[model samples]
Target: MALQLIPLPPALWTSLPGRSSVRTVADVIGSTQPWRPISLTPDLTLNTLLSLLPPAAILVGIASIAREDRMRLLSVILVGGGVSVVIGLVQITSRDLYFFRITNPGYPVGVFANRNHQAALVACMLPMLGVFAGLRQGARAGAKLQAAFAAVAAIALLPFVLANGSRAGLGLAIAGLAAGLILYAGHQGAWSSLTRSRAWRLSAGAAALAGVVLVGAAALYSRNDAITRISSATTAEDQRFQFIPQMTHMTADFFPVGSGFGSFDSVFRSYEPSEALLRTYFNHAHNDALELAIEAGAFGFIVLTVLLGWWATRAAHYWRDMSRDSSARRFGRLGSVVIGILFVASLVDYPLRTPLLGCIFFVAACWMHLEPTGRTQKTD
Candidate 1:
C-alpha cells in the first residue's frame, strides 16, 4: 500500500543529519558495527536507515496531494487503521495472538512488539477516521455513507483501545477526538449557536453512545488486560524517570551538535543512571524532547520548534478563517491533534521508534497541511 511509502524521505533526512564524522570514527573502526557509508551515525546505520524510511517515503509521496487525492488518502488511513484495530481486538483475545509472541509470552501484542506501541498506532489513526466521518462534503449520500462508516468504526474500534491496556493511548484518543469535534463544529458553524437544537442533540447522542460502548466493553471483556491494569494500578516506575537528569547531561555533553542522530541507543548507555531499572541498553531517550536535546541539542530544539511553529501557524490560519474550505480546516485540525498526542505520549514512551506508528504520524501531519484545492466557503 502507498501507506507504506510516505515515511522514507524523512528517514533519509534523519539518517544524514548526524553521521559518522571524525568523532564517531573510533566507534566505527573499533566496534563491530557494520559500515553504512552514507549514514551520519554509523553505530545505528541500519536502524537509522530503517527507522527513517517510512517517514521519508511519506514526505516524498505527499507532494502531489490536493483535493483530488484528499478523500483517497483519508480512505487509506481509515481502512488501514480500522484493520489495525481489528488485529488488536483479536490479539487481546489471544496472547500468542499476533506475530510477536516471543516479546510478550503471556501478554498480547499486535504486529508491533509492544502493546503500547500498538495502541499508539491505533490512536494515531483515530483522528483521521474522525475527520473522514465528520467531513461535511456537498454530497449528502456520500456524507451519510462516511458517517455510517465512522459510527461502525467507533463502535467496533474504540473498545479495543481500552482492551489494549494503554492509558496514554486512551488519553490521546480522547484528545484527538475532541480536536476532531472542534473541526466538525467549525465546519458546521455550530459555535455561532452553541444552544442550537441540532448541536445539543448531536452532543447528547455522542455522549450516550460513548458511555454505552465503554460500559459494554468493560462488561463483556472483564478479563481484558487494560481493564485489569486500570483496576489494579499495576504500573511501576520505569527507568525513564531515573534517567532524566543523566539524559539532560547527555544533551549538555553533546551540546549544539548531538552525539549523533540515531545514536541515542548506543550513546545513552554510558550516562545511564545507577538506579536505572535496565542498564543493559536504552534504545531511546524515551522523552522525545530530551532525546532531541541529547542528540541534536540547541540546534535540534530550534529545528523542532520551527517545524512545530510552522505547523501550528498553518493550522491556526485554517481554523481562524472559517471561510476557508472545510477539508482544508480539517487537515489542519488533524495535524494539530496528532502532534499534540505524540508530544504528550512521547513524554513517557518511545512510540516514534516503532516504524508503523511513526509512519502513520507523518501521514496525519501531511493531511494537516495539505493544500486546499477548492474555493473557500463563506460563513453565513
Candidate 2:
C-alpha cells in the first residue's frame, strides 16, 4: 500500500504500461495532473489491501480458539450454508426476493453477488459434512444418528450444486464429494480388504449402480441442471476467455512491477482486445492467477508459490497422519480437502475474493493446525 503512495519520477512512471492511457485520458478530459506512478489508482490499492482484514481476523480468531470449538464453528458454518441455500431457492421465485440490490437477480445467489460464488461455498461445504458428522464425541447410537443426518444432508446438498447453475462449482462439488468419500473409506480401512470380502465387492457394485442411476436421474430432472447447461453450452466459449490473452499481455507489460492491487479494472482498458469489447466491462480477469499477475506482478507469484508450497506440504502430512481414532486429525484432513476445493475453484473463478469464502478459506487454513486433545471447552 505504501508503494502505491510513493510518487515516482516521470521516467519510471512513463515506462509503465498504463501511463500512456492515463495521460491520453487526462488530456482528453482537459485535466492537468500530477502523476503517482506506483499505482495509477492508489485508492484501489488501499481498498484491496483493506479487504484482506476480515479474512485475516477470522484466521486469528479461529487459531486462538480451543480445538473443540473448531467443530462448533464448522457446525455454525454449515447452518449458515443451509440458510443460504434456502434463501437462494427463494430467490428463484422472483427478482424482488434477492437479498441484496447489487445481485444476480433470478439466480440463486444467496448472500453473494454471484451464483457461482454461492455455489463455490456450497461445494466447499460438501466435504466438511463428513468431518462434522464423524468428529462428534458421543455414544455409538448418537454417532450413528449423526452419520445418518450427514448422509441425508449430503444427498440434499448435491442437487443444489447442480441447481445453482455453476459448471465449475459442480466440478468442485464432485471433487469434494470424492475427497470426502476417500477419507471415509480410509477411515473404514476399506482399501485393505477390498479383494478379501465378497461383501465388499457387492457393496462396490451396488454403489456404482446407484451412482449411474443418480446421474441419469439428474440429467432428466431439470433443464437448468448442471449437466444440461454444460451439455448445451455455446461452442463460442465465455467472454472471460477473450480477456485471458489480453491479460497475459498486460502481465508482461507490467512485468516485475504491476499496475497495483485492485488496478485490473483501470489498467485492463489499455490492453482489452477490440473484438472483446462489449457493453459490459470486466472487473476481474476471471482467471485469478492471471489477474493477480497483472495486479501484483512477480510479488504475487512469489507469495502464491510460498503459499502453495505450504499447502502441499501440510496436505500430504495431514493425509498421511489422519486416522479414524482421532477426530481432530480427521477434521484437519477434511479441512485440507475443503481448502483444496476453493483453491481449484480459483483457477476458473475468484471465489476467495468474496468475504464469506475468504473468511472460510482462512478458517480452514487454521483448521489444518488442529491437534488431538481430550478436553472440550467452549469458544469464547
Clashes of each: 22, 0
Expressed as tens digits, the lDDT of each residue in 254-293 for candidate 1 is: 6755655677876765666566545356767668888877
The TM-score values for the models, in the order shown, are: 0.75, 0.86
lDDT, candidate 1, equals 0.63
- Can you write out model 2's per-residue Cα lDDT over 294-358, one digit (the tens) per residue? 78788889988998898898887665533333556667787788888888888878888998999
Runs in model 1 deviating more than 4 A are: 1-41, 101-108, 136-142, 187-189, 192-236, 274-280, 321-325, 372-380
What TM-score quantifies how close candidate 1 is to the native fold?
0.75
Candidate 2 lDDT (Cα, whole model)?
Answer: 0.74
Alpha-carbon deviation at 380 in model 2, angstroms: 22
Off by over 4 Å in 2: 9-11, 15-18, 23-37, 137-139, 186-214, 321-325, 371-380
* RMSD, every candidate, angstroms: 7.3, 4.5
Query: How many collisions between residues are there in candidate 1?
Result: 22
In model 2, what is the error at residue 311, expressed in angstroms?
0.7
